[model samples]
Target chain A: MLSALPEAISILLSLEGILVLMLGTSLGIVLGAMPGIGSTVAVAIVLPFTLTMSQAPAVMLLLAVYAGSVYGGSIAAILINTPGTPQSAATCLDGYPMAKRGQAGLALGWATVASVCGGLVSAVVLIFAAPQLAAFALEFGPIETFALILLGMTCIVSVSTGSLIKGLMAGMLGIFLSTVGGDPILGEMRFTFGNWQLFAGFNLLAVVIGVFALSEVFIRASAPISNVSELVTFSGIELPRWSMWRGRLRNLGKSVLIGNVIGVLPGTGAATAAFISYAEGRRSSPNRAGFGDGEPDGIVSSEAANNAVTGGALVPTMALGIPGDAITAVMLATLTLHGITPGPNLVQENPTLIAAIFAGFFIINLLLLPLGMALARVAAPVLRIREGFMMSAIVILCALGIYFVRGNPFDLLVMGCAGFIGFLLRRQGFPMAPLVIGMVLGPTLELTLRQGLILTDGNFLAFFTDSPIAFVLAIAALLALMIPIVRNFRTSKKD
Target chain B: MPPTITKLKQESVIVQLLLLITAIALYLSTFKQGFTDAEAAQSPMFFPRIILMLWIVLNIIGLIQSVRHSNVTNPIASWWRILLVIAVTCVYVNLIGSEGFFLPSMVFALICLPLFGIRNGVLIVLFAVAVPGVLVLLFNHMLGMPLPTSRFTHYF
Candidate 1:
């Protein structure tokens, strides 16, 4: 893996690579700065375009968007008092206060610098940690992999907001949906019901766009458009002075550490990391007294932690082939579409591609400082666009993107149904992340479980009894599922 | 709370139950489709059957819990507006195939902008033409990927 860096750097240095990194990052920031378009939706919006790209560039484009959007969210949080993504919600606590106090430029500067540092550090962590983890995961048999995936799915569903039972149901429904195309082992159709389109099952991209992007449009449409107004005026980002780091270096380090740790954990995401880091900063920072009242430390804590999560979330997905959330799931799906299977052997098989991804991710984070400053001016006018036109535009892009992916109109139908259903379910407080994760992980989970069962001669107990790794993972899966429920029950009892 | 909020609240439970029933029916269909020996670990039905059964059970549990402790809140948007958007979007999807991408999208925008609260006629028309045109240019013209087009004009 270390040896692949030269080739990877060469790929990143190419004209096409440079163009993709710059443009993709710029698009991500613009979309992420938009009030309603979050990172997941931003990635989904660009997903269609990547289909025409090659293996490395396609993945690189998405990675650029993912990293850029996470940072771009802080712009909205500081200037407009709106967190573009939920992860940036923590940024609002200090970002908005700073903006209101006439430090909007400085606030954005702190966010940009902190976000870049955190992202760079996380990318370094990814480069170093992913290889080791993948090397370790090489020992994972089908049973152990199955156990890890179970843990991954349950952890995500459990960590998700809203009703646990509903999250589980959504997860199950997603897994069931993945089963529709064909039975992996028997080669028999399970749920297609003789429809030829059902042979390939549901298009994951269509469902992703529908549930994440189109449904978001539907949600916005359903809501009253009262905020179709001008956002806070912002010229561009102002870089914080070098000497300003004075007493805040500790907070920055701690927040980045918190972000990386939370990011590596399955199901826990950037939003959780940011909030946790913010609270930690409030407790431990030297500037604790000024925590939320336009404190630069507050912005640093939230922005650094959330941006750091971009790399942290990729750890499990790259090493174990299990996506932690919807965004990563979409990435894994893209890799699969590019003829690259993402699992433990992924690094061993395609060292150059993996190294290029890691290197490109680093470049994307570095681009944040310069590109963000340049793009902030452009985003202000965009933010002024009316909600009606914006929503209509998203719908059009989603429809066109989905249609062109396979040039199949049926995908549009699937997208429509998924959007409507997703809207209704979201209204009822179901999180869509678990559903997407479930669908992405479902096929692998099934394949591994059946293969493990066959290896054990149909004795399910042997799956755990034979492999210690599988045993540990299975126990972790159980604990992940039960701990949340137990905590909720205890809280309710107190109430 | 308004009666309409209460009604949407009731509809949530209905959605939950409807989801539960649909899941069970699907599971029953799975049994009929010859993955019935789900007890055999190697059978194709083994994994999906587990997921479906678990889903059904979870749905029932959620339904009971929801009915017992409802925390429904009214969203600012009206249900009628949501339904209207869905209706228009469905029409747009059908029209893309029949009338091609450009015309149906223009029509969709012209109708939807006002429905979405755009009051100005000129702004509506301007947007109705420009938005779809830009999208077509991005996908069809710039990328050299052809979008569905009517015989009258190929570029759009």
Candidate 2:
């Protein structure tokens, strides 16, 4: 473990690794600041590049991109009504309004500062918590691993805002999509439908880019605006005074804690965390009336919670090799490509790498202060660009990005199909996040169930009875399905 | 008069009927596939079946809710424009394999930009051509994942 630290430091300190990390961070911020482009796209765009790099530096590049993008989205949310990423939606409730009121500089400053603080705090927590959790996870068997994945899937309901039914449907769709490729356990093709391309299932990066980016371009093209003012000049950026900080301490604390907890859960990314934290903050605040009316506290809570998720998300990834979200999932794939398996044995085999990751987190968080400020200053000019030109640029970028995903024309076709489906779903008020989650987790669930069944020699009851953990998870899933129906009925009757 | 709850309820009924029809079709289609012992649990059909079941249930619930409170606020849809874009995209994708990345992408951009109401055709043309060309250079030449160049031409 001790020897691994020096190696980790050497890898991180190398010129190539440093350049990769810095460039990834800068590009991620730009991508993240664009409305409709999220950290998922940023990570996917960089995945191919990491194919040739070493494990430590490659993973570092992706992580830096993820963290930088998470912070970057807030800049657009603050300046414009539109959020650059879904996670920044809460930031816009107050952030845009503040900008409208001529306090754009102040809002940007507070958000940047709060983001840095939250990221650093969560990084510290991740560094301490990941190793301990990994050590504990080392004792788990396949059954336990299966149960943990099930637990992660069950959290889908918590993220089912606006409509629970739609969320479930979307999640089911995602799971179904995951089943398209050859079965991992059985090696039998499932949903290929005679197309050779389906053998590998749907590439998640392509799906995300299409559903989020391309769909966004299509939606924005029809409703173009002109000359969004980007000229923001700050004589001096004002930090939140002691009184302001003191007043919002409870909200900030609650949001950070909620964000960290949500971030540690697989499939539930920073978007869910930000939304949940905003709701919780609004519900509990004394001045709830000010929530969507440029409240500084609202901005602080959402920004802090969302940024805190960057570090919290790393906890499960580094410790257990189970990625907490899509971005980390890609990072895990990169790690695997580089001949590094990031499971329970990772720390024991390479402690220096783990320590270097922890140190990298610290460095990235510190760098956020300057990087975020500079970006905010630069992005201010974009507000003045005509909506028509902006829309054209975004559409072109989306097309190019999808093209680059696999260098296959068929991939673009898949993207177009997904975009069409997403458009229909949006029209019907069905949320898209669940579909993505379902796609991500579908194969894992199917494989686990099959393995468990195979072990039990075709006993139907064995799924529930053979393992206590699986039984518990099943019961929990049952309750989750029922509660929403019950709540909806109760609410309808009351209305 | 605006569409009342009753009219919205009727629409929901139609939606529910369509969903039930689709569900039956999906279930029937599932029978076409043959499953072996190893493929039984994690077959391709397993998840689609699950999704179909969930979709049917959700649609039914949605239908019921719409019927119960039928005050629907339908947003305006520019279907003609949307269909045009989709058609263009399909055509662009079909052309990409034969013509390669550069020309098809540029043409696709030009056709689509007009949908955004950008009347400056010259600017649009420049943007459409320049952006895709630059990207081909960046991703293909710089990034070393050069997009498929056209077999018929030596433009690059």
Candidate 3:
């Protein structure tokens, strides 16, 4: 990773690179500031346009959107008192109150500064950490990779923030959906049933856009349309005086650290990081007394942690081919669409491209400060558009995105069906994240498991007995799933 | 959460039961699709069958848990509106194949505005026209994506 920096820097110094950084960041901030669109939907919506781009720029575009959107969420949190993204829910507690007190500009200022610092630091962490992890991962064989995927699969239990059983069911459904195509190793079709389209399976992008984006439109369209529009007056951001930073530096640093650590852990994400950092700031900050009532420390805690997660989340996705969330899964899918298969060897094989991504991510975060201030005005008016128009636009864009991938109108039907199914499942308390992640992980899980079984002559237990790394990972996966269930059982028993 | 916990449990049960039946059907279909029941590692049916069996078990478990836990998340305002949106969306999809991208999307937006409670006629026409127009320009013209073209190719 270090060796590629010179070449990476040269790539980023090119015209296309600079334009991608600027446009992607600016577009990301605007989209993120939109109230209804979360980071996943935002990324999914922008995904198809990236297909026309080169490999490095395509990945960089999504990264910019992911980072910029996380920061952009804080704007809505402070100004509208409604979080633009789930990760910014913690920000609303103090951000809204601060805005209500006529310091909307200052509140946004604190959030912007904290977001930049967090994202910048996490980028550094990714630059140092992912390559080391990938290096260690080079030791893995099929069995160890299988065990690691099993560990990754334990994340379903964690991400199933709804009913555990329902989450597991959704995850199962996702795996099933992923298997709809032809079987890889056997050269025999599994579930295609002689349908030629099913040979390629459900397009991942179509499924992704359908479930995440279109389902959202359906859900929103089903709900009551509020007549009231209440947004705080945000003329511009006012940077906090240098003296205001005197007491908040520790809290900011701690929040960024919390974000980076939690982000690297599969299944845990920005929302978790934000809440944890906010709680920590409330506990240990010098300004703890003002913690809930428009405190700068509160905004710093939530905004910084969530933005830092933008970089932290990429570590596993890039180095190990394990996506911590749906957005990163989309990233991996983009890499695949561009004919670059993602795995531990991704960095080793595509050093210059990976370097470009890493360097572009850093630049995107740095661009956030100026873009956040500039785009807020542009986004404010756009936010006032009626939900009806917005929903229709989303459906059209999603349809177009699916069709353009292969000019296959059949994928449009696939997308529509997925969206409808997603809406139905969501209504039944099924979380969508697990299903998407399950689909993303399903192929690798099956491939590695089959290879491992072949090596062990169909003895499943030998997966644990043979490789110590596999053994440890298998044990970790067991504990990860079991501990949660045990705790829930104990809690219910106490209740 | 719905208006009542009872409603939530009922909906959850329906979903679980439906999935359970689907899993059973899918497991049977795996063999019908020509996957031989060859021993563990050798067959194409190996992983999917295991997954289907687990899916069946999980759905049954979920069915029981839904009735017992008595809570579901995400409240809906009206099922009628939901059905209406779904119906319009279906029409929109069919129309896209027959009519082309622009007209169907415009009609979708125009109808959708009223359904979502937007009443201003001018705003309706504006959004209806603008949505598809911008998409065609951005996706088709600019990005080289092939959106379906209608009789009025310029608009499409």
Interface RMSD of every predicted model, in angstroms: 1.6, 3.1, 1.7
Off by over 4 Å in 1: B1-5, B34-39, B151-155
Q: Tell me the lDDT of model 2 at A412.
A: 71
Candidate 3 chain A weakest ten by summed lDDT: A221-230
Q: Write the per-residue lDDT of candidate 3 for residues B4-25, one digit (tens) a residue.
A: 7677677777877888898999
By TM-score, the better pick of 1 and 2 is 1
Instruction: Give candidates' CA RMSD values in order.
Output: 1.8, 4.3, 1.9
Clashing pairs in 1: none
DockQ of each: 0.70, 0.40, 0.70
Using lDDT as the yardstick, the better of models 2 and 3 is 3
- Candidate 1: tens digits of C-alpha lDDT, residues A1-495: 779989988988999999999999999998888887989999998998888888888899999999988988888888888887888999999998888887788899999999999999999999888889989989988999999888878866545687787788778878888898878877888788889988989999888888989888888887777564445656677888989999999999999999999888877888889999999999999999998798999999999999999999899889888786677877877787677888789999999999999999999999999999999878767777788988888888888888888988889889989998998888888888878888888998999989988888898899999999999988988998888989989998999
Off by over 4 Å in 3: B1-4, B36-38, B151-155
Candidate 3: lDDT of A84? 82
Q: How would you encode candidate 2's per-residue C-alpha lDDT over A385-466 as one tens digit per residue?
A: 5555655565456555556546777777887777766665554556666676566556656666667656777565776677
**lDDT of candidate 2?**
0.71
| Sliding window of 10 residues with minimal summed lDDT for model 1 chain A | A226-235
Please give the lDDT score at residue A436 for candidate 3: 82
Candidate 3, what DockQ? 0.70
Candidate 2 lDDT score at position A310:
87
True contacts kept of 2: 0.36
